[model samples]
Target: MAHFVPRASFSLPGSIPKTYFLGHHHSGANAIKGILNTINLVIECRDVRLPLSTQNPKLESLVAGRQRLIVYTKSDLCTDSPAATHTLRGLYGADNVLFWDKHRPGTTGALLRKLKNSARAIDALTGLRIIVVGMPNVGKSTLLNALRSAASPEKKAKAAKTGDQAGVTRKVGTSVRIVDSEEKGGVSGGIYLLDTPGIFQPYVEDGETMIKVALAHGIKKGLIADEILVDYLLYRMNHWNPGLYSRYCEPTNDVNEFLTAVAKRDGKLKAGGAANWQEAAARVLSLWRIGKFGRYVLDDLSDEAIRAHQHLLVNPHLSQNQAKKLQREERRRARTGD
Candidate 1:
C-alpha cells in the first residue's frame, strides 16, 4: 500500500467518530474512497460540473448501501432552479439524496432544508460525523463555515484561516471540528466536520497533471472571468488544449500562423504592419479563462492512474504497486491463458 499521509489532523474529541463527508473526483475522490473502506454516511459537496463517470469509485462505494445526501453548494451560481436540484433527489431516490447551498448566507434553498431534514429521516444517528470534502475554491472551506455558522447563533465559527487566493490550502490537510454546534441554532445534535485539502493530480516529474485538476474544478475558467485572468489561462491552455486553433480562424499546423491570426482578429497588430504574435498568444490564453473555448474535462485521468486501473482489471487482488510490478505476470497469463 502507498503510505497514507494526513491532509489535515483532526482534534478527535472522544474516540475517533464514525460520521464523515463524501465527494467524488478532482480533489476528494481517492481519500474519500479510503474513508468509505471504513464506514458509512459522509457529507459531500455537490459539483454538477463534474460528470458521474469521471467520479472515482473510492467515494461512490461509500454512497452505496447506506444514507447519502448531495449538497448543491454554490447553488447561487447554478443556472438551474431549486426545483431542478430537488428533482435530482427524486431521480436518485427520495431519501437517498438531498441538496444545499452553503454559498447563500441563509439556508433558504431546498438542500439546506434537506440537510435540516436529514435528522428526521435518520432518527437513530444523532451524532453524524461529516467529512465535508471537495476541491479548493469549490468552497469546501466556505461550506464548512456556513454550516458552522447556521448551527451556532452566537460567536459563530471563525473563518478557518484559509486563503481566498488559488491553491492556498496547500500541504497535508488540516481539519477543525465543531465540537459544540448547539449555539449555531442548528439542531442540537452530535456532529463533527473534518475539512481536508483539495486533492489534485500527483506530480510525476512536473506540475502538468495539476493543471488537469485545475481544469476540472473550473479554477481556470474562474481566473479567465476577468480580462487579466483570460491572458493567464490562454497562455497555459493554448499549449495545454491545442483545440484553440479550431476555436478561432487560425492555422492548426503552424504555431506562428495561429498566433498571428489571433492578434489580427483582436486588432492588436504592430505599427510596422507585423502581427503582434506575442499579444495573440496572450489573447488565446485569455479566451479560455473567459470560457470562450467551452467546458472540458481535465482531472487525474493521467497515464499513471489509467495504467493502474487497467492493471487492477487483470490482477483483481494485487495491491496497486504490486499490480504495476506484475506486468510480466500478466503477460505470462495472457500467453498461457492461465
Candidate 2:
C-alpha cells in the first residue's frame, strides 16, 4: 500500500500526463462549448460506487448557476443499500439528484418523468437540451443510448458509442437528438442530449482518490501499473470485505504472493509451470470492477472528510495540520446545525 501511494498521488504535483486527457480539449471542446451555449439543463453523471472521487468539481465551476442534476449511473454495480440514496442526496444536495441503472429497460422513462416533474417551470413548447458529463467509463454514452431508446422506439441504432473500457468516447461534445416533435405527434416534443468525453482534473490531490478512480475504471488502464492497482485493491478488499475475498483465496498481505496464489488456483500459468501473476492480477481487478466483491463506496464522504476536502480545495496553501483543524471545526458546526 505504501509503495503504491506515490502513483496514486502523482497528480498532486501537477505531473499528470497528456495521456489522461487524451485530446479531450481538441476533440471535445465543441461539445463543452455547445453545452455552455445551448444547454438548458446539465445532467452530471457519476459512478455510483465512487461518487465523490469521480466527480469533476472543475466542471461544476464551469456550469455553475445552471439547473444542474446529479445522476448516479451504474447503480446495478453498486452494493449500497436503499439508505445510500439519502446519503448521496445529503452530500450533493436535495433536489434533482437521481440513481439510475442503465441495464434496466424502464430507467429512461423514469428519468424522463423525473426530469419533467423537476423542470415544471419550463414551458412544454420549450425542448430540453441536456449535456451529460462525467469521468470515463461512468456510462455517459450508455445513459444517452437509454434516453434515445426510451424517447423513440423506432430508432434502433445507438446514438452514442459505448463499451466496458474507458476512453471509448474520445470525441467530446457530440449532439444527438433523442426526441423530436414528429415522434411525439405534436409541436411540443424536442429533447436533445449532448455527449462529452470523460474529463479529469489536471491534478488529483490524493492517492486513495486516484486508486478509487482506477478501480472504477474512470481512468484509462496502463496509466497505473496493473500490479500497483491490484495491490491497492487487495488491501482494500482485505480491509473492507475480507470474507468475500477469502472465499476465493486465502488472506495474505503480500501482493506478489497473493497474485501467485490466485494464478495457481485459477490455473493461469507461464511456460515453466510458474503462476502467471500478471494475468492473476488482471483477473482480481476485473472481479472487483464488476462488483464481484460486493458494493463499496470509495470516497470517505463522512462530514469530517468532506470538510477536510472542502477546506483543502479552498485553502490550498494551508498546511495539513491547519486543514485538519478546519475540518474539525466544520464537523462541530454541522453537529450543532450552526
Candidate 3:
C-alpha cells in the first residue's frame, strides 16, 4: 500500500512504464494513482465519473507520451453520452477514447485488442511496458477478469459470489502479469493487467451524497435520476411510489412536509396529529432501498460548479513560473484587447 501522501504533493511517481487514472474519488483515480506513483509502465487514466468528468485539465499533462485508453464506464446508465464523448475527445482527442460497461464481461476483448494495437504502434518506436490504470470500481477488476477469461478459459471462472458483495479471486496474482493464464489473449504471452480496489477519497460518501459528489466532478452533465433518487425516498414516506404522483412529487414539494404525512400513516405520530419527520425519512431510506423507490441517478452538482472544479484541478499546483507567465499573457492580451 502507498503511504498516505498529501493530495497536493505533485511529485511524479518513480520512473515506471505505467498508466495513471486521475480523478477526485475512487471510481478510477486511486488504482491509477497507485500504479503511477509506484510502478513504471504507467500513463494515466481519467476518472470519467459524472462529477469529475471534464473537471480536471491537469489530467491531460499526466498522459503525456504514454498509451491512454479513455474508458467510459457505466455507459449504460449515464444520461449524457455524446456530449461526454465530445468533451473528452475535444480535450484528449478521439484516438484515445473508448467505452466500457461496468457489469458486462465481454468488453475486455475489445479493450485488449485496442491495447495490443496501441502497444504495437508505440513499440515500433519508443516507450516501455504498458500499464492499465484507473480509479477504483471503474471496472478495473471486471476488466481484469474479462482479460483473464479472454486469455484462458479454465482460469476464467465467473465472479465469486459471497453475499451482497463480490468475492476475491485469489488465484489471480500478487504482482506478476495482469491476466496471466487465459487462452487466446492470455497474459502468458505478453499482455498484463493490474486490479486495484475502489478509491474512496475524503470527499466520497454513500447513497445520495455519492451521486452528488460524482456530479460535482463534471463526469456527467445532467441527470434527472438524482432528484428521482431523493424523490423516491421522500415519496415512499408519504405512502406513494415515484412517478405514480408526478405533480405531487415535484421538486418544489418540501421533503420535510412529505415526511410528516409518512409519519402519520406509518404510526410515527407524536402525541398530537403531527407526525415525526426524521423517523419517517429514515424509514423511507430503508423502503427505497427495498424497491419502494425506483432506481434513480442523483446528479447533485450543476454545470456551473463543474466548471469551477475543472478550473481548480488544472491550477491546483500552479507554479510561480506558470503564474508569472499567465500574468504576463493576461497583461499582453489586455493591452491588445485580443
Q: Quick one: best TM-score, which candidate?
A: 2
Q: lDDT for each of the candidates?
A: 0.45, 0.70, 0.43
Ranking of candidates on TM-score, top first: 2, 3, 1
Number of residue pairs clashing in candidate 3, backbone atoms closer than 3 angstroms, sequence gap of 3 or more or interchain: 41
Index of the highest-lDDT prediction? 2
Q: Using alpha carbons, what is the TM-score of model 1?
A: 0.48
| Worst-scoring 10-residue span by lDDT in model 1 | 15-24
Clashes of 2: 1
Stretches off by above 4 angstroms in model 1 are: 1-40, 62-64, 72-91, 94-109, 120-126, 134-138, 150-158, 161-185, 199-214, 217-338
lDDT (10s digit) by residue, model 1, range 1-338: 34423222112123211111112222355555556533334555544433221232334444556455555444443332334454445546766554444545555344445555554444434444556654445556666676666655464646554544444444323444443444555444545566655542211111232233344343323322232333323443444444544555532434465566677778769998789766675666545434456433322234565466445434445354553344445345435645
Q: Report how far residue 296 has shifted in candidate 1, in Å.
A: 9.1
Listed per candidate, the RMSD to the true structure in angstroms reads 14.7, 9.7, 14.8
lDDT of 2 at 115: 58
> What is the per-residue lDDT of model 3 for residues 215-329, given as tens digits with 9 covering 90 to 100?
2222221222333334433433233233432433333245555565567668777776677765665565455433344433333244675566556555554555554454455
Cα-based lDDT at residue 300, candidate 3: 29
TM-score per model over all chains: 0.48, 0.82, 0.50
Instruction: Please give the lDDT score for candidate 3.
Output: 0.43
